[model samples]
Target: MVAPDERIGPAQTGALRLRLSLFYAGFFAFLGVQQPFWPVWLASHGLGATEIGVILALSIGIKMFSAPLAAHGADRSGQRRRSILVLVAGSLAAFCLFALTNGFWPILLISVLFYALWPPVMSLTESLTIMAVQRASLDYGRTRLWGSTSFIVVALLSGQVLVWLPPSAILWLSLACVAATAAACLFLPDIRTERSPLHRGLPIVQALRIRALSLSLAACGLIQGSHAVYYAFGTLHWQAKGYSENVIGVLWAEGVLAEIVLFAYGGRVTRHLGSVGLITLAGIAAVVRWLGTGLTDSLAAVVVLQALHAFSFGAAHLGAMACIGETVPASLSATAQSLYSGLVWGAGLGLMLLASGWLYHGLGGSAYLAMAAVALAGTFVALRLSALTPRLPQP
Candidate 1:
């Protein structure tokens, strides 16, 4: 475990905070460009909806296996930062392979490699930031907010850039952003935590035996993965409804902006509401959000529901991270984080996305109703999780 003092601190932790914030900002900026535009770019290359879903699913699915491998490497070597840099470099190379070819099989192969190299970066980075906060007395939200802000900037600007340039530019933009992330990685301080010789790495079986974590992951995964319908098809839906590219950008930015605000106040919210309550709230919001998204066609109604992203995504994410951070040991932090990301975010999400693609083809807008049902199921899990686990002490 990190020393108690290392976990909580005053707002200003000096230069380390600034450096870490910049690193996250650059990394998330890359994601902002990729997440919202990558599908659109794939479409331009002649991939159908199902194919697009498959490709995206494949990319994410690889993370299920890859994240654990990366975490194991980091844990065994006790070189978190170095492992992250190596993976980032590997991802860059894989993406470069994507740029060189438009062939389906080649791109698919590259997609797997690209995603395989990608998952560890975020998990390890979070572990690093948490360590820094523990050691230096810094605010996680204040430091992490830079990434959200950078994402907003990129989302908005990339919209305008896409308007003036071809869709092909999306790849270039992604490459540029990742390059910037690499530069930022160079500035992070190398801080090692107290290693436990008794370190029994993440007992996957034992952790799974903890019914709350397992159930929470399942519920959260389905609820969150339900967004695959939105993530994969929302922009297309909006476009089919006659919205412009710029309007789509605004909509995307609005959700992320709400996410930013949630993160900024996350610590306080966690303190006040606790993880179970917050996650329950998020699950409830997702039910309403997805159902409203399915029931309404009005632009105003759509915007209102998108704003609910603050709770559905932002709050739920905060709850999960806090839960994982608290329950997992320092030695197994990376592995646990990866497990959450891999099993829930990667596997659960991938399957749902694939299903959503088929549903979109068969049912059009009504497919989101299925997504709402998934969210409702997740709400039950969240409530159950609250009942099962003991709340950890707050900072």
Candidate 2:
């Protein structure tokens, strides 16, 4: 893969957007199935809660290093789509190993390899989407909304499917998504970005010298990282509080539904408020969301408050993307995306998740107080980011 000297025409852009959308839809559709239900499958295999938690934590922790390594290779090769295909294939093979083994150690070893390759796909794909967004003058939120939509669809549908099928069927369902994503990659436009002399083929450390890039990444990561407690224990907490399984599921679905609405109108939201303001809104909403979550036992209130996930996750992410678009150079795009994924989502959230288990054990719903504080700090960081905007000039 080599970077082109000039941007392509719209006819190509339109086609690439559809293919990219399909790729995201297929990939995240699998995530929708995997995240919530994989544990159920693990439990069905007789893995204890401790074993399951360790496996999940290990899988997430591995990505802090693995994703960045994978992104570095993709950037060096300038072949993001090709990198994704390899990861999908490698992960699928690992999943097969998981299927053949029921023992704890075998499953753990295979899971490590599987997760190391798989998590990088999104960071790498985001880089591709960013490049395409730059070349095509597209809307990132609108395009990414398709992935969220697919996530919701698969999550709901797979729940029903799981009721009818055996637990072991999850691996096959995951494989189908991997295969579909690989096929979609085949249709991706064969495009690469030319190296910028400004970047001077420098390392990621040098890329971080840009204050806006680093600050924005940190802020967005914290905002995203704040979701750790909610993701890990939200269902169990609700269940213990006497909410039925179906109701707890709706609470989860409500958040995603709100996120979809936010993304669907994301362009309008960004245009009305601007990027910095949008991120600030996300931070403030997160504060309220988590605090309310900690304090409330009112089901009606939780339902309404769950809508705040839209601002918390969606707007904070769009703000980060906007910052990267305006501040980071195209040459450093892949590095920046991976940094957000590896550091923010992978390492930062992984640590928070570990803490959440302890907190949930000790304080139950009051565990959310810590998450609220986390979001509050992130809110302040986003405000700082708003004040420090710097654009990267084309070389």
Candidate 3:
């Protein structure tokens, strides 16, 4: 029998793709529930806006340290699946602690443990998926779109469920999702790359020396981080506007539905636009989307703006993955992926979450205008990035 880490043939490729797709479905189902409603659960505990902000920001911020450490170890060990299993198992254990807590401080402590372990799973999975894309000639977007599909389904279902159940029901729903993720991890392919050489100092530090990669990371960070206000409070904002939970769920699902379309045609889009072009497009879309969101609460207008999530999120994400896969060596792939997630989602978004609480509390829906400015800054960075890396990655 061939080694698990060896190059997969056609027979194995089919099975590998199936297993990876299942993992994405299970994992993102958890996010579908948590992303839109977790704030409601926190609010139900009587924590004010500032307290919720601190909890969310601190949880994300901790990833800056924890993600790098976990990925670095994964890189050194060259055991992607084992590392993922361990992380997901720990995440499940930490998330369960929510059942035992009620107050801000106690919940905050558990959130630190949960968020720390939960996000690195995405980074590592990205590394594995990209490897599959290269070796098996799989379409990265199509395979990954399974996650978005599951996300939308679960979001819609949970929305209906929340209509009947109390906010605390979110806790139970999320627990089941987390357990499903851990169970799914057990079936993931063990497609390990060669261990990264540690004698060369930190891989991420070395990665910083590549000008194109550095600029790409910065550009992606700003663009993705611009979603802070929306992610943290979009549901709550709509709730205050008198929209039902079901409608709010539909709005969230609508955005990801557009994202799914983009991912389904990812390869063709990448070929036409390239990585730099995609990021440029994303920045532009974000500027318009946030501005429109800030200006109007009309259902029609909100629906139109939400569609821009395809470019702002889906394109930016594909562009970043292409940049990493093209620029980084296989040995350093896990480290590079982790660095992107840690810095962009972890630190960049964490800071924005901190500011978003203040922004939302003070300005309400108008807080989206601030996010528009953030996207505008990212557009400038991406434009400059286009000049530095004239020949961009097409993956």
Candidate 4:
């Protein structure tokens, strides 16, 4: 492994991890509130599944382009932290407009503003976290676990809170989390890009050209993108099935709780299996998980399936991050991170959302069948990834 630390001293490396961890915790707390319950809030507006799908799809699609552009700037200027601060502030301001509108189109417009600004920040932050990991010999999973912790907390608590409050409260609570994220971003390292000739010579397209890198991104896209229906309609579907909001929240928490433990322990496990091996496991588990989710409304069955989040999401993500960290050099770090985020979460999720709307309406619980198919395809891609020769680092 190449340990490129951007010339920071050993002492600063430890603090950098803590700062990055806090940023993850705060940002995911924001996600905790939004991801599970935002649909409920939109439903409160009387938007049907098709409309909500379009709104969510557009949000996902926009990030495909927006994150890369922002990340390119971060990579070029070597100001990842500063760029994130601006994004956080801009997203907060955009969310503020949500309160001023109640109609479908108006809220959708504000979402456009909000999604464009917020989704890109995480890829930029991931670039920072991965760089620190390479230099300091830290674990990406451990640092990322904090975000999962906050996610569970907010999911459980907000579910309880929503029982007493209107769905509208999600906006204010989400704002508070973003504000905290902004505060954390201020503490992050302001490391600049090294003026090395190797770094200077690397172009963004080169990362895409490498067979391993592109395959890794494709495998991740299929695996991670498979969550589209769950992210968009899991709560609504459960609610329609008569599960209480609190139970719905617990269901969401259960999945991420599995993911949290995976992050805590994935370091040694992934080290042995390597990124490609872990991704293969992730794809296989995703197929099983979604297959079960599509087949049953049995709460016990559903809860058990959610446990596969450890493999389906946590393992897949851990492997993908490792792949990006190991394959892409420091010069293209942010750009590569954005590419992963855009393609996997951005385009993949976006396209799935477009389909999930129609599927959920017609097939109900069986909508997850579509996702299972996506995961199955990703498994085949992972097999291809395993066959590629690893690229050696160029200094």
Ranking by TM-score: 2, 3, 1, 4
Per residue, candidate 4 scores C-alpha lDDT tens digits across 266-345 of 67877788888889999999999999988877988888998998999999898888888788767677888888888988
Q: Model 2 over residues 100-212: C-alpha lDDT tens digits?
A: 88868888888888889888878877877777767776667788888999999998899889888998888778778877777776776655754534445554765688787
**TM value for model 4:** 0.87
Residue 275 CA displacement from its true place in model 2, Å: 3.2
Query: Model 3 clash pairs?
Result: none
lDDT of each: 0.78, 0.80, 0.86, 0.82
**TM-score of decoy 1:** 0.88
- Compared with the true structure, model 3 gives a TM-score of 0.90
Per-candidate clash tally: 2, 2, 0, 0
Deviating ranges (above 4 Å) for candidate 1: 1-12, 39-52, 133-137, 166-168, 194-212, 239-247
How do the residues 1-395 of candidate 1 rate in per-residue lDDT, one tens digit apiece?
23322443354467778878988898889888987799888888877877876887777888888888887766555567888889888877878776788856767777888888987788777777766644664557778878999988898789878999998999999999888888888877665544433355344544565565677678778778878888878988888788998898789879988888888887788778776777788889998998888888799998999999989988787777766655655655566667788987888788888788789999788888999888889899888887777776654
| Model 3 local distance difference test score | 0.86
**Which pairs, if any, clash in model 2?**
3-192, 3-193
Which candidate number maximizes lDDT?
3
In model 4, the Cα lDDT at residue 329 comes to 68
For every model shown, what is its TM-score relative to the native structure?
0.88, 0.93, 0.90, 0.87
- Candidate that would win on TM-score: 2
Off by over 4 Å in 4: 1-10, 40-51, 101-106, 195-203, 233-249, 295-302, 361-367, 390-395
Q: Give the TM-score of candidate 2.
A: 0.93
